[model samples]
Target chain A: MVSNTNELSHEAFLYLIRQSGIDLDTGHDKELFDYVKSVLSSLDPLRSIDVGSTEPPMMFIPAQEDV
Target chain B: MTDVNLCYASVRALSELVSKKQVSPVEIIEAHLQRISETEPVLNSFITLLADEAQEAARRAEAMINRGNHLGPLHGIPVGLKDLFNTGGVKTTSGSRIFDNYVPIEDCTVASKFRAAGAILIGKLNMHQFAYGPTGENPDYGHMHNPWDPEKIAGGSSGGSGSAAASGQCTITMGSDTGGSVRIPSSFCGIVGLKPTYGLVSRNGLTPLSWCLDHPGPMVRTVEDAALTMNVISGFDPKDVASARVNIPDYTENLNKSIQGLRVGIVKEFFDAPLDAEVESIVRKAISHIESMGAEIHEVSMSMFEQSQAISGTILMCEAAAYHRELLKDHAEELYAPVRLRLESGLLITAADYLKAQQARALFNTSVNALYQTVDVLVGPSQPITAPTLLAQSVEINGTRVGTTAAVTQYSRPYNITGTPAITVPCGFSASGMPVGLQIAGKAFDESTVLQVAHAYESTTDWHLKHPDIAS
Candidate 1:
C-alpha cells in the first residue's frame, strides 16, 4: 500500500489499475497511466483534510413514506 | 410578423399570440423548422430533427386553441431537449457511439411535463460525449459550433442547447449541469442559463453523469422565459429520490420585484483569481451598473471557494466511473478519447480518496450557506474568459497559459458543489466581439431571488437581444 498519494510510482499505479479489474495492455495504456497520475496528484491535498463525523455527501434520499 | 421575428420572439409573446388566435401554432413551428434548415449547416447543433412530429403536434395545439382551450404560458412553443433526455420511441444517443442505437421506451419526467404543458418538442440537441467534457467537442457527433463565431466553441456538454437557443433555432432548451455544463454554454453563447437548487428539478429520466452533481435545468433566450419554463417543469416527483418535497413556488412571481434594498455580495476571491482582461472589465462594469440601480454592494469572502474545483472533480470522476464501469470494460474502444481517459482515471481513485472529497464537499456547502446569511445573493463572472477557438486546447489569461477546460468552468462549478441556484446572463461583450456573462446565485431552493436579480440586470442592458450575424 502506498502511504503517500503524491509519491505514487508508475509501477504501483499500474498495479492498482490491474487490481481494479482493468487490463492496461492496450495502445492507450501510456496515456491512461499519465491521466491516472494527474488525477491522483489532484486528489493529494484532499487526503489530509479532517472530515470528522459528517455524513458522506449523498444527493438523493428516499421519500418520507419509504423512510 | 415575419418568420425571423417569430423565431426570435419570447415564449411569453408567442404564447399570447397563440392564445389570441393571431398566430397559429402551425405557423410558429413552420417558422422554426425553416430556421433550422437554414442554420443547421453552420451550427451543427442538432443530432436529430423531428420535423414531421413537430408539425403534427403544432396542428393539434392549433385545433385545441381554436376550441378556446389555452394550456398556459408554454402552450404552442417549440423547445429542444439536450438529447440525453429520454424521449419515448426516439433515439437518445447522448453524443457517444456506445449508445448510438439505443432507443428509450418512455419519455423522461421533464419531457413528459413539457408535453403536458403543450410545448412542442422540435428536436434533440448535441452534447459532449456522456457529458464528460466542457468544450462541447464530440468526436462521434460533429462538433457544435458557436453561433457568435463559427470558429470558436459553444461551451458544453450542453453546447448544442446554447448554440441553438442563441441562433433562434428554438425558443427554449433544457440542459444538464454536472460541473457548469449548462452555465458555461449559456455564458459563452450569450443567453440565460439557470441551474436550480439540487433537488428543485427532478432528474428522473435524464442520463446520469454524476449522480450527486447532475442537475437538469433550463437554458433560454431570456430570464423570464427561464422562469416560465421552471414553473411548468419543477415539483416533487415520487420517482426521483433527489426530488425536494418542499412546496414549489412560482418562479416568475418576483421577476418584476424591485432589488432596490437587496444586499448583493461580490465575492472577492472570484475577481482576485487570474482572468482575461476584457472579461474582468465587463464583469466589473456590470457590478457598477447594478450598484447604480440602487442595490447595495459589498465585498465578501469564502476561503473554501478555492477548494471547490478539486472537490467537484473528485466526486464527478468517482460517481461517473461507478455508473460507467461495466460499459468501460466492454466498449472502451468506442468511447471518445477524453471521455474514455476520464472514466478510466476514476479506476485509480481509492475509496478513501472518494470519501475525503465528499467530506470536503460537505464543509464547502456549509461555508457557502453561512455566507448567504450575510447577503441575499452573490455576483461574479460566470466564466473567467470568453469562448476560445476550436483548434486551441489552451488559452492565455493574464499573461499565463491555462487549459481551456479548467478556465471555462472555474466560476460556475463551485455552485454545483454547494447545490445552490445560480444563473448566468449576458452582461456585456468583449473588445473582440465575444460575450461575457454575469452570474448571480442565491441560497438553496431560492431560485426566485436569483432570477429576479438576473432579470433586473438584463432589463437595464441590451446584451441579451444581440444576435450573431451567422451569414457573415
Candidate 2:
C-alpha cells in the first residue's frame, strides 16, 4: 500500500537519482540535481493572474480598444 | 552457416528478389527461423518465437503475390518488435515480472504499420525491464548476452533488438529509447540504430517509460535498412499529441546524396576526454574520411552540450515515476528487482521538483538553440567504450572505474534531451576486438543528413559487413 504523496525530502530525491542509473562516479547526480534545482529556483517566469467578469480569455475577435 | 551474407543484406534487395519470384517469402522466413533456432540458444535474445504465425503470414503473402496483390514496399519481409511494444495475443512483459501474464488487446502502432507494409513479425525481442537501464540486465529474463562475446552485456534497453538484428534473427527490429536505448545497443552490437526525432514515430500501444523521452525507432544491421524501416514508421498520429505533424520524407531517396559539401561539426571537448585508444582512433579516422570526401569537418565547442544531460535525468525520472505510480502501489511485489527499485524511488519525488525540472528543460533547450546555427550535423564517438561484461557493475578505464550507463550512453543521451535525430552505426572495433560506433546527430527533424552520413560511412568501410560470431 502507498501513502504520503507530499513532503518529500532532499535526501529522498537524491536517492531516486541513484536508482535511475545516473549515479555516476563523476558525482553527476549531485551536479545535475543542484544545477536543475538552482535553475528552477531562480526562474520566476510567471506571476499571479486574475479573471474579470467582463473579459473572456484573451485574443478573441479583434477588440476595438484593447487591440 | 547462417547464410551470413543475407543476414546483413538490405531489405530492398530481399524485396526485389521476392517480387521477381526469384525467392518466395516462405523461403526467406524459413532461413531466418532456422538461423534464430540455432543462434538464439547462445544469444538468449528472444522472448518468444512466432514461427507458426510468421509462416502463416508468409503463406498469405505468397497467395497475395500469386494473385498480383502487392501489399506495399516492405511486402514479405520479416521483422521483430521489442517486447514492450504491444502485439495482441502475444505476451508483452516489457522484460519485467510485473506484467508477465499481461497481453494487449490491440497491436502497437509500429506493429500494425509493419503488418500493413506486409512485413511479418518473427518474435518479440528482450529488453531492459520497463526500458529503464542501459545494461539490458533483466533479473527476470536473465539478461541478453552480447553476441560478439558471451560474457559481455549486449547493451540496452534495446539489447535484444540489437543482438537479433546483428545476428540475422530478423533483419529489422524496433526498440524504444528513453535515453540511448536504441543507439547504445546498436553501438555495442555493431549495427545501425536510428532514434528518430522524438515525436516522429507513434507511441500509442507501446508501454511508456518517460512520456517525453521515449522514442520508438528501428535497429538493423545496415544504414539503408534502418532508413527503410524509418520510412515505414515515421508520420503524424492523431492519437499521439507529441507526434510530429510534419511530412515523413523518403529516407532512401537521399541515402547516396553526396555529403561532399556538408559542414560536419566535431565536438572539440569530446576529443579531449580519454576514450578507448582504438575507439578514439576509429572516430578520428571516420572524421578524416568524411572530410577527404569533400565535406568540411570543423572542430566546434558547445559547452551547453555537456549540460543538456542533467535536464534529461530530471525529465525522465519524474515522468517515469508519474507513469509507474499506480503500478508501484498495487504490484510492487510483482515488479522485477531493479525496475521495482527504480519506480519506487520515482514515486517519492515531489511534483514541484518535477515541474521545476520541466522549467529547467526549457532553459536547456534555449541554451542549445545556438548549436544548430553553426553546424549542419555533429559527429562523435557513440559510446566512450565498447560493450562491458554482463552482470558486472562497472568497467576500469585509464585506472578509473566508470559505471555501465555512464560509459555506454554518455554521448547518446544529450541529443535525446534536445529531441534531435541521431544514428549510430559500426565504424570499427577496439584492440580487444569489440565493435565501436560513430554517432551522427542532425538538426531537429533533419534525419536525412544523419542517414546520408551513415550511409556514406557504410559505403566506405567494411565494419558494417561484419557479424557477431554466433555460429557454434
Candidate 3:
C-alpha cells in the first residue's frame, strides 16, 4: 500500500532514479524528483482501497493457442 | 450550397449528394480544402495537409461513382486522422518533432479501413505531442486553437481532430482516446466523439499511448457520422492482439431507433466531484431531456469512480514510459517538456505500484459492471468546464482551483479504465458561448445503444447544427 502521502526523501529519490537505469542530469534532479513524488502521491489514495485477491487483468495468449 | 455551408454539411448529407450524383467528389473535397485554407490560419489543426493528394483521390472517386460503382456512406467523404495514425507514404509525426521525418510504408488498420470506405484523406491533424496531455499545447507543433474562440484551447491529444471537425476543415476526424483524448476535445469543440469498447476497434496502425487504454474512435459533427465511421472500423484485426472477435454490427442500422425503454443512470459522484455549476446544470437538463424521451432515469452510486484517475494514471505512465524508454534516454530533449517530464516520472513507478494499480483496476471494472446491471448507460458531463485558455495552468470550478489536467480529465477517465463504449455529444453551450458536452457511457460493446441515445438527444437539440463563426 502506498500509505505515504508525503514526498520521498532526497536520498531515496536519488536511489530510485539510479535504479531506473536512465541517466539523470544532476542539475534538474530537484524538479524531476518533485515530479516523481507528485505522481506517487497521486497514487497514494489507491493503496488504501483493498483490491483483495483481484488479478491485475493482464492477459496474454500466444498465437498458437487459437482454435 | 455555399462553400462554407458545404464544408459544414454532415457526412450523411454529403454522402447522399455524392451517391445521387448531385455533387461530385471533387466538389466536396474542393469545398473542404477551401474551408481549410480559410481556417488554417486560426485553427492550426493540420500538421500535414494532403491538398494535392486529396484532390487526386477526389477525382478518382468522381470517376468511380460516375461509372456506377459507388461505395456507400463514406465514399468521397473528407476525413482527417490524428498524426499518430500511420498513413502509407505520408508522415506520421504523433505530434512530436522527434518523428517530424518518420513515414510508415504501410497504412495502419484504421487508415486502410478509411481508404477502403472510399474516404478522402485531407491531412494529418495536429495533437498533444505523443498524445501525452489533455490540453492541445504542443511546443513541437503550435498549440491547437479552439474553433469557438481562437484564444482558448482545443482539448488535446485529439485536439487537432477536434478542431478540424468543428471548424469544418474535415467531415470526419479520428482521435485516439487513452484518457479522454477523443471525448475531451469532442466536448470542448462541440462535436461528437465516440470511444468504442476497449477491443471493438483495432489499434494495429495507431501509435501507442497506453496499450491497455488506447482507443481509436471517430470525432465527427453528428452522432450518425460517428456511427457510420464505427461501422467501417469496428471488427477483429489479426494484427491487433487486443482486437475482439465479437460479431460486429452495422452501427447505423439502428441509430435512428427509439430509446423509449432505455435505462440511463446518473452517477452521483459525477455531480459531487469538482464540477462547474453551469456545466452541471447543462448536463442535468440534458438528462431530463433524455427522461422526457421515455427513458427511465436512475441515480446509481459508483464510489470507485473517484479512484479512476489514480488507476489510469499509473498504468498509462508505465506503459508509455516502457514504449518510449529509448526515446527518453536518447532524444529526451526533443520531446515536449511536459511530455518529457511525464515519461521520466513513469520510470519512477515501482513494479508493485503498477501491479497494485492494475489490481485496483480489476475491482474497479467489477464495480462498474455491477452498476451497469442496474442501468443500461451512465450519463454525465463530458468535462467540468468549457475550453480553458491555451496553456492555463489551472481552472477554478465551484470556487476550487484544480490543476488543468486533473480538471479536464476528471469525468472522462472512468470509461477508459472500464474499457467500455462512451461518447460525448454537444448538449449545450456555456454562457461564454463555448460548447458543453453530455457524456453517455454504456456496457462493453454497446456502442449501438450509446449512439442511439446520443443521436436522439442530438436530433432533439440544435447544438450540433451551430457551427463556429470562424468557419464562415
Q: Please report the candidate that would top DockQ against the real structure.
A: 3
User: Which has the higher lDDT value, candidate number 1 or candidate number 2?
Assistant: 1
The number of the candidate with the highest lDDT is 3
Interface root-mean-square deviation of model 3 in angstroms is 1.9
Q: Tens digit of lDDT per residue, candidate 2, span A6-64?
A: 32345655665545443333454454445434333322221011111222111235546
Model 3: DockQ against the native?
0.68
lDDT of 1 by residue, A43-64 (tens): 7667666778877776565757
Which docking band does candidate 3 fall into? medium
* Clash-forming residue pairs, model 1: none
Cα lDDT tens digits for candidate 3, B339-409: 98899889888888889999999999989999988799999899999999999999998889999999999
Q: DockQ of candidates 1 onward, in order?
A: 0.61, 0.06, 0.68
Model 2 misplaced stretches (Cα beyond 4 Å): A1-67, B1-5
* Regions more than 4 Å wrong, model 1: A2-6, A59-67, B1-4
Fnat of candidates, each listed: 0.64, 0.02, 0.80
TM-score of each: 0.97, 0.87, 0.97
- What TM-scores result for chain A when each predicted structure is judged separately against the true chain A? 0.58, 0.33, 0.70
